[model samples]
Target: MDELNLENEHELLNSLETILTSECNLHEYIDDIPQIFATDNLKTMSHKEETNGENIETLFDKFPMSSNVSKDNTNEIVTLKSKCEELHTQIERLTKEKEEAFEEIERLKDQILSQSTYCTSLGAVLGNLTWRASRFPQIVDTWLSNFQSKIGEFLSIVNGTFGAFVDTYRSAFPPTSNVEYQFVMGLLGIVTNISASPEGREFLITNSSGMEFVQKLIKLMPELPLAPGTVSLKRLMLMILYNVSMNKTGLQYLLESRVEDTLSHCLDDEASSEEMQLLCLRVLQSVTYDLDKPKYIHNLIATIPIEKIEIITSAKRSDISNAAKQVIKYLQHSQKITK
Candidate 1:
């Protein structure tokens, strides 16, 4: 029994030594923690770290210095700066592109504004003359053959009456009576109405007169800043000239005159309306209709652009739209003949 107590005492002494060694190791671990925090270069740490050192307990509570967390944050900052620079460059490029697009749009708007009147107002005049011709088919036929004597004697109005109409106008026009302009429009309207017909075209062509009256009528048209009466009279003259020019003889007659230059001068008239401009275009179409005449064809090609023509083809008025379509057709025909 004595031997058993001695062995048990020996075992108790060994267990006590083990307990003391564990206590020493724990104190060493606590002592090393502060040194690790003091030497670390982590910049995101609080002001306490920069001033002195953090509390020993707080040093362990935060992310560890050996975890590579600070390195990862540095990489993230660099990437964000690069992205900011790239975005700034993209914004500059887009601003330049937008400015260029706005300039192009302004140029296009100017082109369309110049042509808008022809597409809208000219259509009404063209439709009116066509309607009148269709309504009094027989009368137009009789008048076309004997314009001065047949219809002229009946109304006491004749082609020579246009000469007197111009005499009523002066250099200035603001105080002019608006009612007197109708007589000029009426006489010319009847002539255009008659000329627009197929049978009427035949009379103008076959009659010994053959637009001799029209050649004289063109000379009487007043120059620009035109009185209202002169403007109405000239518009009628253009319509008559356009109808006459639809034929080979009329085309030949016009090519021989300064009418092409006259039409250009009329177009340049600041006082000219869209209806006047449209009549000018119709006359141009007839004059340029002679595809066999290279001079006329070249004149047309030089005078108008394909894009401008394409824009007018969409005119809100059907007569203007149809006329534009016919103009485009003539242009295409001219192009093919040239090629």
Candidate 2:
């Protein structure tokens, strides 16, 4: 029994020595090892190691880092949302810019087309009229013949290019000579001649820019100096008004324009010649002749100077007296109807 006991103690010491030699290397880092099994109670050491592992797992479960991960995820989502909104705003701005660019392009295209017509076809016609002063009538006649069927189209050209020409000449410096003025006069004369015909009258009445052109002409008339040199200009303009009045539409436009007021002023002006007064009376006669509408006729009667017209009814010139008498008759009829 004693020998057996000695052998058991000797075997235990050898096992302890082997474990100590394997676990402790003094040449290596001490922090590389987590625990030292210093006791000979191996079973107790194993139990303690298991308890420590469980405590570590419990500590991690109590205070987890998942909330920081959640916050980071939320921040990332917010950043992405902001970027998306910025992209959307950029898209909207780009879309609006695209639409505006298209509108500008369309406007530019129309302007280019108008300028092209001004430089080419209509420009060529006006150039000929300006350069060829002697053949003015023939050129006008030939132009009318060639474009009579397309009067509406021709008037469109007049509205665009010829209108520009009139403005240019009217505003030109005196150093440019009287040719420009005469060119404008010639153009107005062409318009007057065009107004003489029924088809031409209708075009002037109904075409989109025709009455607008007439309005412009009337506005220009009052600005012109009605001297001996401008008598023909005034006469041509008055003749256009007279011819336009032959149609009901034309008459309405004239009455609304208060052309009677202008006529009355002309009659009252002492500087106005007998021929001008006669022409004025004739225009008044035309203006009152075709008035089936009582309101327009009434407006004319109310607007014109009745006493002045009555005084002229007994004038020396038969034509002037006759025209005054006709106007008086129309006014009397209108007054009787109103009563």
Candidate 3:
């Protein structure tokens, strides 16, 4: 009996050892095996064995290589977190910069609007100012010099204002509502005084800078319809053309620009005043006298309203009659030559 009890006890110790090794490998076997070790002594022995093995495994987890790996992982996490914070700060700064840039752009736009508005208001007194300026040759000379020096700036404003006027005139836009008309009239008044003199005409059409202004002006001329409402503007434009036409160089420039087409349209518009008709006729007559090219004469004849001009030859106004007669004679001669 004593030998059998010792054998059973030794067998139980071997089973407990096997179970503890399995529990260490699986981690779940410890709880499951405790039920099999129901006796108090066996349970106590199993607990003691599990506690010892757990302590050994905990020491292995704290080995130098594992400790170094944990430290490296903690450092990497901290570095990534700092980079994320830096990126967030930079994003906020860039967003603020973009907003500031947009604000500056809007401010610049407002300033430009204010200047244009001021120019429109200034137009009301431009006629008087130009008249006063014309009396002083020194002022006129200085003005002309300044104008030539800043021709580009001058034209930008003039052309923009004129283009707006053209739109207002062409559409059903309220004529009085826009500053374009008043602004144009004021500038035209100054231009009229400038073009009236031979020196001024040369400065306007012969100078390289002046040619650009003239070309732009010519391009805008055809867009103005010859109606009663627009007649005053048209007349101002015609006067400028006529004054500039006195210069041979200016005339050539005008002819090459096909200004005769615009003149023809004016002559045929019927809404044209007698004075306007006379101006158109005179310009056309000048074209006939200066036309050295067959193509020019042909173009002149093609564009002019011949029958209407012939009727004007017998009109009551002697100036208009004489101008029309000369233009008709040139057209008739050109027609015969073309045939």
Candidate 4:
């Protein structure tokens, strides 16, 4: 029994010595290692330590240091910081440019306001000159020559000023006054002559911007207390209507407004007079000839009292007889179609 115990004791000592030598070698290796860590590897080691309560410092102590990798990371951080500063500088430059553009817009607005005020003053001065020149033919002729000399620069200004002046002053004087009638008639006659020109005809048909003004003048016709013996306002109105009727557009308006209804009232009670009959015939012929439609002619026939038709039929004059016949034919045609 003593001999067996001695052998067992020797085996136990050898195993203890082997374990101590391995522990000493591992310690020497760990002490020689450096302190540098990879970011990715550090994250993994941190997770393992949290889960198992392991020491991360012991694992990281086995890795070696690298000065080259440390220097590269520091250089990357400095580059990113410099780029951010350049972007801030660009943004500041753009902000100043925007402020300068806004200031320029405000300056232009002030200049435009000053120019508009100056134009208004000049317009008033030109309007007085036009009104004065219109009173005397010799002065008007001279003024027109001067106007043509500066046509390109002042045409638009002249038209606007004179148009406003005429609108304001033309109605102030009575239509029966010889001077007023002459002024109004002379202008209308000139316009009519111009309208016959090729350029004027093209302007009237294509542009037609003056149509509203013509309609306003038509409405003012009844307001003029013109005596037939003195001024013949009716004749003048007829002439105006005939001129405008050259284009069917204005005639369509007269038809729609039933302006012909007023014609019978203008006829004198003394229908036997040649002048009265001729005037009545002319008005009738103009309406029927221009409109040339059954319905419009029927409306005119309806407005004339049947007694007036009887008077027209019994009239001895050939002109009056012809006018009555034309009206009767239109009425007959209208009734036949309605049936």
lDDT of each: 0.57, 0.62, 0.66, 0.48
Tens-digit per-residue lDDT, 114-208, candidate 4: 88656654544554444444445554444345653342233333234324534554445434433434444444444344333333323333333
TM-score of each: 0.45, 0.52, 0.58, 0.40
Clashing pairs in 2: none
lDDT by residue for model 2 (5-104), tens: 6775676456445434423321121332223323334345344434543543443354333332345534543454354345435445655665687799
Using alpha carbons, what is the TM-score of model 1? 0.45
- How many clashes show up in model 1? 0
Better of 2 and 4 by TM-score: 2
Q: Kindly list the per-residue Cα lDDT of model 3 for residues 161-260, writing each as its tens digit.
A: 6666777666443353356565677667666677777777877776565676567667766676544457667677787787788888888888899887
Q: Arrange candidates by lDDT, highest first: which order? A: 3, 2, 1, 4
User: Using alpha carbons, what is the TM-score of model 4?
Assistant: 0.40
Give the local distance difference test score of model 4: 0.48
User: Tens-digit lDDT track for model 1 on 100-162?
Assistant: 777899998988976754543354365345446645777666555666455434223434555
Quote the positional error of residue 318 for candidate 1 in Å: 10
In every candidate, how many clashes are there? 0, 0, 0, 0
| The candidate that achieves the highest lDDT relative to the unseen native structure | 3
In model 3, residue pairs whose N, Cα or C atoms come closer than 3 Å (at least 3 residues apart or on different chains), thus clashing, are: none
lDDT of 1: 0.57
Residue 263's lDDT within candidate 2 is 77
